[model samples]
Target: MCHIMHIFLNIKFFTLVDFCNAISYEHVKLLSILKLHNVKFFQFFTRFYQYHQGGGFVCVTTARVCSLLQYLFIVLFSTFLVECVDYPVLFNNKNTTADGIPITGKRHIQLMTLIFVLGIDDDNLGNLTWCEVLALLCQKLPDLHVIITKDKLNELDICQRILRFKNYFVALVNKDMLPPVVNIPFLGPQPYLSSGLKLNLDFLFFWGSFSPWEGPYTLKDEYKDPQNIGKLSNSFVCINTQCHKFFIYTINSCIPSVIHFFLLCGAYKKRSNTKLRHFNELDHQLQIRLSRSYDFATRYMNLFTSPLIEIIAKSLKFVTGSIFAVLFALAAWDEDVLTVNLEHALTLMTATFLIVIVCSSMITSDDCVYMPERLMRSIIACIHYAPISWEGKAHTRAVRKEFDSLYPLTFRYILEELFSPLITPFILFFWVRPRMQKFVEFFIRFTVSIEGLGDVCSFAQMDIAKHGDEKCIFILAIDGVAFDKDEDYIANDGKTEISLLNFAAMNPLWEPPPLAAEFINDLKTHVSCLSVFLILFEHILKNVW
Candidate 1:
């Protein structure tokens, strides 16, 4: 028996090492100790049982049984294979130096030379990469400030510089060209520059407008439009236009009113169609108010029909079912080998049946619990955003009814129709673990953090600042409709000390106004919605699977 145990341990250890080499060293060590103790205990128990048996036939039978058990253990251990799981690669070799040295003075000189050469070509100025732009800003621009700004500098120069170079800088960064070389120790290849560079630039270049001036504008003909100037592109350049004095003005402030123009255009164009005409002239303000009201109602509905609770309940049901399955297998095997009183056996079978019934009921109930809430939310979203009309309303109603009818049977249908045959294989091959969950959560959060329009805007602004101040000169490039009849002259408050360029007009649906209270509230709502969505997705993945 001891020899058999030693052979089994050797086979188990070798198999485990081959199959699960990626598992931590500590875990492998612990498994070895556990296997040794378990083998010793089994050997001792078998020997004691055989000695207590007085008959030679019984002793022989016990020895055969022990041998059979050892063979079974060897087969089971051989079949238990775990795939190696690799750790995620977070850093790359390209961004770090082998010797862990900082950027040397000689390398800095090389970068500066590259920037100067790139800046000499008017046509290629916008084509400079992110490394060239940073070098230009850090090394050359400070000394050439007078040349770029023409000695008419003031506090407004900062604003103008940002406006001019924002587009070019954004282009470079977008291509992942910034921080030309990373020489950090232990933590590289190169990661992106700090988020502050993008954020501060976005705030600086928030407002800009077109102005007619006389001088050489370096930008391409296609980029002359004001709308195209601030967008992400490598071809943006500042024009050296002549104006009487430095001033900024808001050319078109009430841009959100264009929504009315679109609505009216649709209404007039489709007036002959009764269904389309009904939605064409709907009040925008009324829709917004109703949407807000619906948002409030859905908050409470979500609380009552929380998807997380439903998912947890379903997970619990799965766990209970698995336990019952194992117990049933064990009970059947025991009944074949061991004698038991009829009354005790009956009681055990009855308890197992009751547990199975309860688990099935719980799973069924949990499966459909959140379906009503989802249907309601979907309907609300459709109505809130869609054009208001009888046709649209009818479509939404049809969707709602369809969802209601399918909710109760959906999970069962999916399981039986899609997963019935795969269930055993899935249980054998797949497992849920905390580390995998953490990796998924980290990835989601990283994605959500970078989704904002402001971040892109910021990167664009910084790109512009890196080129030079000459790119800040005013140019006439009007694209949008004029705000009023008085668009000919610059609307200034005659305050030269303060620039009007600092003010940005509010667009209700696009960029929110910078009013403190409204901005804060909107930010809070956006963050809350993002957090809820992440939680819901995580729960669904965990419980549904």
Candidate 2:
């Protein structure tokens, strides 16, 4: 018995020593890993601060290179950033002129023109000859002009006075045709595609609508003849001198003002897709689908799995804790129950902070409550896992950074929600209200009144006849009637057509209209051809390799 006990004791001692060594090594390894991460975190933030402050060049360049990626970051990061810093402080940190006028799109375009079009260096942007100014106007200016008869000399005088300030006038006219140059990428020291760009500008000047603003902003009065209020523009030139007043300039420039107002009212749709149930409020087919989706999600889908629900649950807990804390404070302070004292007040304040901020933070941090165990292995994975592609090193890092920024996984999200009520009103009043006119114009111009459907978004109707691309080779003649391919109907980017096809495929029982059937066939043919071309190209490249 003594011999067996001695052997067991020796084995236990060795095992304990080994365990201690393993623990020590793991502890050191963990500290080193954490230290590395801390350094990387500090460097990342320092670089981000420097990058954002380096003028508008970075933002503009990023937007041009990958607009979708830029938008994703803006949506994901801007919200979190908004909580920490004011929007003006975040976006307007760039260097500005001594006059404090932030760089506008108009100014950017002129700068680009000076560099790319005129081949003028940055230092010599202001230096211009009378001939050079005229040349710029003749080449880049929009075709729009105001005709004044001899009797309307006052108008001519006004025009002359406007032209006196040639620099500003040039900027204004350039705005009419070309989009802001900030949208265009920088093309180094040498002017790239200067000839083609100049030719395109010249074409726009001669053929495009000559208006101060685009089609969406055109007024109803602009379309009507000054002499005869009812007479609008029509096809073909008027031979009669009297009919000259009704010359058609551009259809877009002649849209009624009321349409613009309507567009503004309906521009911002709520995030919820299935909120509208009535057919009148939505499309007939859309209404049915929305109803079915809502019903199915409610019945079969786990509501707790929704991120929105998780947020709401956290908010409710915070609210409840806050209410209880307040109630407890009121009850304890009541003269009848206990005498109010400084010590008691201080204790109450501390308890309130603990209940509201600290406890709420703890509750919010527990993100696993809503996420399914099957979907994610643990809370660590749920928090750190970012679905990002590894194509470009820089791009991948940016997307990962943005994804991390989106889910701070702290009390910040809850705090943001708490403060949103105070901030949202100011945003609506100052930002959205000021631009109400533009929004209204967009809605009115894009919407059309159908016979049975009443008023619907023109884009949603999928009317190839009205909005179909003329250059789309897939469009074929059905029966005796030929579909006109001359009109530019590139609205919705074929999303509506794709959605229709998807719906048809999902619901095999559903029958499409004759026109829609024809459109689907053409689209399918186009897609098949594209697929074949891609496959063949891939095969050829593989064989070559």
Least accurate 10 contiguous residues by lDDT in model 2: 4-13
Where is the poorest 10-residue window by lDDT in model 1? Answer: 494-503
Which residues of candidate 2, in runs, are more than 4 Å off? Answer: 1-395, 400-416, 465-494, 513-515, 525-545
Best by lDDT: 2
Winning candidate number (TM-score): 2
Report the number of clashing residue pairs per model: 11, 11
Predictions in order: lDDT: 0.29, 0.33
How many clashes would you count in candidate 1? 11
Q: Write the per-residue lDDT of candidate 1 for residues 3-50, one digit (tens) a residue.
A: 211111221111222212213344434543444232232232233222
